[model samples]
Target: MRRPDAQAREILALAVPALGALVVEPLFLLTDTAIVGALGTDSLAGLGLASAVLSTLVGLFVVLAYGTTASVARRLGAGDRAGAIGVGLDGTWLALVAGLVVAAVGAASAPTVATVFGAAPGATDEAAVYLGISFLGIPAMLVVLAATGVLRGLQDTRTPLVVATVGFTCNALLSYLLTHGPGPLPGLGIAGSAWGTVVAQLLMATWLVALVVRGAQRYAVPLRPHARGIRLAAVAGVPLLLRTVTLRVALLVTTWVAAGTGGESLAAHQVVFTVWTFGAFALDALAIAAQALTGRNLGAGDAAGARRTTRRMVRWGIGGGVVFGVLLAAGSPWLPALFSDDGTVRAAVTAGLLVVGLTAPLAGYVFVLDGVLIGAGDGRYLAVAGLWALLGYLPLVAVVPLAGLTGTTGLVALWVAFAGGFMAARALTLGLRERSGRWLVLGSD
Candidate 1:
């Protein structure tokens, strides 16, 4: 085999650590699910609904990460380190405010949010409890997101990888201890899991904030939030927020459909969806790399480098997806056992896993292209493209229930519409945009 090219080496340098960070990000949820799953089917299903709502809320603000990454990387590439840090600081401040507002609202309306998914009464109550406590962690979560973007843009994915690894470890230890009974520390059921995760998130956020602050001070960048800077950051994030909202809505709808199918099916779908999300984030490691590298290249006016990087990363993305798909397919028989004890739930999860495995490659393609556009600061196009993709997804999902399917068969149909139809729609839209070559604009905008 030939030696790796310079661009390939560069990509790996960023992507490898980024992979660790991204993969660990989802492990937080996966761990919580595994722990809370022991509480029984209703609890598992409830956590599913709460997780869906919480993720959607956090995901809508993903611009805190993606937007900051692009802006910081561009400025850094243009040799304005101080300016880059300033943008990241602005994002962090915005995250704090947004998180506070969302937490207050989400906590107050926990039952309303939980019931919207239509899970069983027991599951709904459990979901509400989890949601109420979990909302308190949103600020830390968003802070971590914005701060991680800063590090990634600064070409320091290793810091995030290390911090996330430690955080996940803390979450796992705490989740196990709190979720289960031990001496005086009695178990709090799903609430215990929520508290554990929140504490771990707070720790991670503290570490990240300190790091960003130190970086800002080193660059002589002001730590205080500037009105104009914060406003500009928010303005820049709106389109990305729209893009993220459409994506989140699609997921929320999927959870709603799963909820309507019955508790067993909902529980199974929850496990499978968590695994699918884990795989998605695994693939998104490459996307994160693309965001950093592409923005940097364009900021340096090296459009050719950006093009070459994109081409190379696309191949890597597909290859990574193939590996993950194979793993998902191969593990389907045994994977569900780890999450639930119900035979029906296990069977449903196995079927869902197969569907997710089949669609993994398509997801890889869609995600990388998405990162490329976002890195180019082409959020406007992305927002429109996301809408088109969501429209395609809604009709296909609608057809699932309209067909009058139920039980395992219904779950399979829903997964097909989601894994197959939704991902395919995303691929089509992103591919068109990539082929047009319009996102390769130079300089920090």
Candidate 2:
């Protein structure tokens, strides 16, 4: 009992900083938008296009962090500190190589990508300029993602918190200086914005690499990449990659559905989705905590301890979800008003928020079990299960519009399908696997 409570404390310790670190990413982008917006409408639009392109690619590679965390945490828990650092180094290598490939591709296709994204006629050239310049930072950004995972696995979220905070501050300052070009620095317009962000990314990656190198040295781990280790990581990451693909598909389908409802509905969806994203990311901190803690306990051959840790996390998830749900539901009527003054838009948003409140606790269940399973290195099952969840929800995505629900009421129906139905599908799958207790992979590979 006390042991579980103690583990709860540990989970919170990790989760709180992880949450802080996580928000820095959005804030960084927001800083870019604000600074770039002053450059002109074309520049602002270009930044939007380039940022969307950058984010989709980066999102796909989040597995780098997830995979590295699992590998490093388990290895360390198995009492192989050197091995842990070695595996993390391999992840860095993979990130570097992957980042380079994306940079090359993006640099070459910046113009084509902007066109495909339907950049407005006036913004197309600017979008290409911004995107091509932004490609310069892809490698460093990927390296930062991988390195963050490495530190997280080492049970040091605080380092990433410091790194992200400092990096965000630097990025904001650099963007302002470069955009304003107050002294000596040439304000290169959109190009300057891209360059400013790139400079910050490079600095962040440099700091992270230094941290990883120092850790490797302390653990007596070689900084060189391991061929076999890289192979192992790739195999482990593939399933997670597909899992992410399914998640992306679901979001896109939901967006498509919302768009089909018309501009007002689309606007309402964006507002609701933004809030949902915030809630999801916040809950995901618990999942990250679950990953490191569960992996460590399992690696140490404490299956019982792992179970206890997971159950405690689940309890925390449940409590947090319930609290969020209550608050969301209570404020739903007014929350939407913050985003819009239109009664129709507010009504739709309010309906969506209420449904979100109902599903928030369910999402907590999905996220925590997802972390627990991933921590156990059960990626194969997760991929399949995630696909199944997507399958179960796609029909609802199609039906929301077919059901002929429009306006605020229509938005309500769409959300019921998207939030309520889709999340329940995930909860069902995760819950089934959890009860089976088969996700408890005994130890590190």
Candidate 3:
């Protein structure tokens, strides 16, 4: 048989599972919204508030995964297989420690945070209950995040995708059964949703650990503790961590501002944002692919190859964006009904979908460029660019209300500003850096 072409195979290896995992994330959240919306508007609102808070918090630790993946990819490119394993193990420890801290803080401050989000009086209690339960599973969640990052770094997106699919499937089944109280199952309401996620996290974490243990024989280095390595890893990772946290706080604040508008406004914002995220995640797989290919090429001292690969991926990302955007626009009316039956919510979501459709293709460039930067081991630039984006949020917030665009219109405008501005800055920075060819000179080790 004729050998398959390298680029074609590489694209498939990265894109397929990455897209599946991304799609699955929205499916899980959509499922939650559907189940909770059936309970009542209050239940739906509470779940939305809870999710906004949780997602922000989780986004903070998500840096660990991102940083870990970049570092491991560099090591792999450098042919330091032992170093890659060490980085992965150290990242696992870091994620666990960080998760514990988050759990403690989340448990103690769930009520206060929920209140700050302006959750309705009745919704606050439900939000608090759900947040508290979800916090307990933070450690497991972090482990899975770290493991998935490591796998991606090793150019193995398929395994993480499989694990995530299993976890999400289980979560949906348990959540539906418990929340609706089918047969002998007692209805636990909103809390049942949180329980489903927690249980799934535990299962996914366990499976990841087992897989890592079994696969260790393939690594050049043994997966063991490295107490002395913490300082170096911490130093390399701290800036990225802070950057992630800052960006996450910005998002949390944006949600808080939306809440100040009204419940329907917040709900509408959440639905549109969720749909936007689907496109973001789908394109991000390409970004991940770019990161891997670029990092590997850089490590091999192939600057031309890296540049070519990045350009190709950017085209692919944009194409995916256009396709998904058209699909989202076509289904604008039907999409909101997937979340809520409320006519107001449906109308708001449908109105916003047009802007979402137009902006998504533009937004795809940002995702692809982000992957290129990360793969280049350009974390500092990522951090700085994010800070720049955060600064833009304030102006968008002030302008939204002044113009009398309260609901989805304001939200879509804000996202467009975010995606457009960040991509411009990132492109300039990366373009300059790539032209200088300094990235090629940097040692992966």
In order of appearance, the predictions have TM-scores of 0.87, 0.97, 0.85
Q: Give the candidate number with the greatest lDDT.
A: 1
TM-score of 1: 0.87
Order the candidates by lDDT, highest first — what do you get? 1, 2, 3
- In candidate 1 the C-alpha lDDT for residue 355 amounts to 91
Sort the predicted structures by TM-score, highest score first: 2, 1, 3
Q: What is the total number of backbone clashes in candidate 2?
A: 0
Query: What does candidate 2 score in Cα RMSD to the true structure?
Result: 1.7
Alpha carbon deviation, residue 171, candidate 1 (Å): 3.1
Cα lDDT tens digits, model 3, 420-444, are 5544554565566656666554446
- The most accurate candidate by TM-score is 2
Q: Summarize candidate 1's per-residue lDDT along 1-445 as a digit string, tens digits.
A: 9999888888888889998887787788889999999999999999999987777776777789999999999998888999999999998998898889888998899989899978799999999999999999999999999999999998889999999999999999988898896678679899999999999999999999999999999989999989888898889999999999888889889988988788899898888887888888778888999999989999888988888889888888888888888999999999999999999989999999999898888888888998998898999998998899899899889876787766788899999999899889888988888888888787766
Root-mean-square deviation of each candidate, in angstroms? 3.3, 1.7, 3.7
Once model 2 is optimally superposed onto the true structure by TM-score, how far is the C-alpha of residue 101 displaced, in angstroms?
0.6
Which stretches in model 2 have alpha-carbon errors above 4 Å? 1-4, 184-186
Residue 107, model 3: Cα distance from true site in angstroms: 2.4
